[model samples]
Target chain A: MIIGKVSGAMHSTINHTFYDERKTLVVDKLNPDGSLTGDYLIAIDTVGAGAGETVLVIDEGNSARQIVKEDNAPIRSIIIGIIDEVYVKI
Target chain B: MIIGKVSGAMHSTINHTFYDERKTLVVDKLNPDGSLTGDYLIAIDTVGAGAGETVLVIDEGNSARQIVKEDNAPIRSIIIGIIDEVYVKI
Candidate 1:
């Protein structure tokens, strides 16, 4: 899981079936040191991650298909968890 | 899957539950036409994606368990597929 920040929210009212009842979000990837990397993505949010909160993002096709329980979702990235703390040795 | 670029690699010696025996890679988020978004992440590589290659990342938990066929893996982010093209009608 990658540490990231909720940059914004993406609200759409149409075609994507995967995001039909979900909230899409823009997450800015972050380094372990908390430096902003500027990379951003629109992800489907199941957790209540809000803007500015540090979160854990997941990206896998088969894994993703299993999470949302959809076989034809055009999804790759998802906001799975909110990070409270991270500790690294060395 | 979200469009992204593999920026670097992260190799570790122990302690993580999900990434054991997997090659971890750092991916940079990118826009279409790839202008470099600056966000980066360390993802478990199941595919043979190399550095500088644009790929797709999946982020979800229960789905992750279903994909790798593991129930106790603490994984949320995974390198699922490589993006070849994207056509948005915006």
Candidate 2:
């Protein structure tokens, strides 16, 4: 899983059918030291993570679909967990 | 989902509980134009993707588990499909 910060929310009126009950969020990838990696992705929110909160993102499609129990969701990323702390061994 | 090329294979005798029947592969993320982005990841193979094959990767955990029919698998990435062609409208 990749560490990311919820940066913003995305609203789309017309999207795939599986995204009906999901909220999308824009996430910026973060390094282990909590610094930005300058990369971003739009991910579905499963844990009600808010903007600026650190989240664990599942960046695969099938696993993302399984989180919502949709076998054929056209989604690739999802926020699975809200992280409180991260310990990196030096 | 992300497009990637299977660069190599991974073998771990001692791994997580869910990885017993899985084959791990090393994949390099690729851009739309078939160029390397220099990003690499280790992914479980659901399909029979081999070295040098372009494949579609699911980077999520729940979906990865769903593909293998394991709910509590400690895996986050999996190869889902093999790509045939990519069309980019410039």
Candidate 3:
């Protein structure tokens, strides 16, 4: 799991069948203390995460497919939860 | 899926059951033109890939596990094929 921020959304006319009714989000990777790393990935949004919201992203394909209930979907990254707070134990 | 080159190998004493007889490799990411991206990842190697060999990697956990014949392996990145050549049609 990774803590990331939703930067934007994406749209495509001819998308994979799995993404038919799902929203795609552009997520910028964040460090533990919430600093941008300049790395981003396209993820299918399961949680209703809006732009500027911190989210919990699962990059594992198996877990992601299981979450979406798709047996053989060409999908990987997925936003599983919207984060309210992040605690860094120091 | 990604194109990468094996940079090094890893050894762990206390290993996961699924990785008992598997070899872990450190791979550096490559662009379409074979340029180093300064990003790397750890992957379990299925093919007999040596260091400096460009390989095809499947980052999908389910597909990787299926290749290794493990139904519930906690793995994602896997080296599936060694690249002979990459023709970039640009």
Candidate 4:
């Protein structure tokens, strides 16, 4: 899993069946030290994470499909948890 | 899913329940144009992908768990398919 910040929401008129009730968000990847990596990804939100909130992203496909209980979902990324804090020990 | 090249294998003495009999590999992320992206990841190989082979990676957690048919696996990344070719349009 990786830490990311929700940047914005994605708007799509047509999508796969698994995404019918899911909300897609634009997320900016964060380094372990909480700095931005300048990389962005569109991920489905399952934990009700909002913009600017830190979230835990699962970037695997089968695991993402397991979250929604779907066997075949076209999605590869999904937000699974909302972050409260992150501490790094040097 | 993202495309990557298998760099090497990973060996661990201790792991989770779902990792039994599974092979771990080191994969280098690749750009869409088939260039190296300089990002490396440790992934569980589900297919028969070996070193120096191009493969498709499922980087989500739930989806990865679904692939193995395990409801609770500590793994986050997994190899799903071996790539035969990649075509990009300018």
Kindly give the stretch of ten consecutive residues in candidate 1 chain B with the minimal lDDT sum: B11-20
> What DockQ does each candidate score versus the true complex, computed on alpha carbons?
0.11, 0.09, 0.06, 0.08
TM-score of each: 0.53, 0.55, 0.53, 0.54
Q: Please give the TM-score of chain B in predicted model 3.
A: 0.93
lDDT of 3 by residue, A1-90 (tens): 888888765443332345556676667778889998766666778878888889999877778779888776646788999998888995
True contacts recovered per prediction: 0.17, 0.10, 0.04, 0.10
C-alpha lDDT of residue B29 in model 3: 83
- Encode model 1's per-residue lDDT on A5-90: one tens digit a residue: 89888777876565677878889887855687667677777667888987767665554565677778787777666665444222
The better candidate by TM-score, 2 or 3, is 2
Chain B TM-score, candidates in order: 0.82, 0.93, 0.93, 0.91
Report how large a share of the reference interface contacts model 4 reproduces: 0.10
Clashing pairs in 2: A59-B59, A60-B58, A60-B59, A60-B60, A62-B63, A63-B62, A63-B63, A63-B64
Per-residue alpha-carbon lDDT of model 4 for A8-63, expressed as tens digits?
A: 99777687766777799999987545688889889988777889987767677765
Flag the better candidate by DockQ, 1 or 3. 1
Candidate 3 lDDT score relative to the true structure? 0.74
Is 1 or 2 the stronger prediction by DockQ? Answer: 1
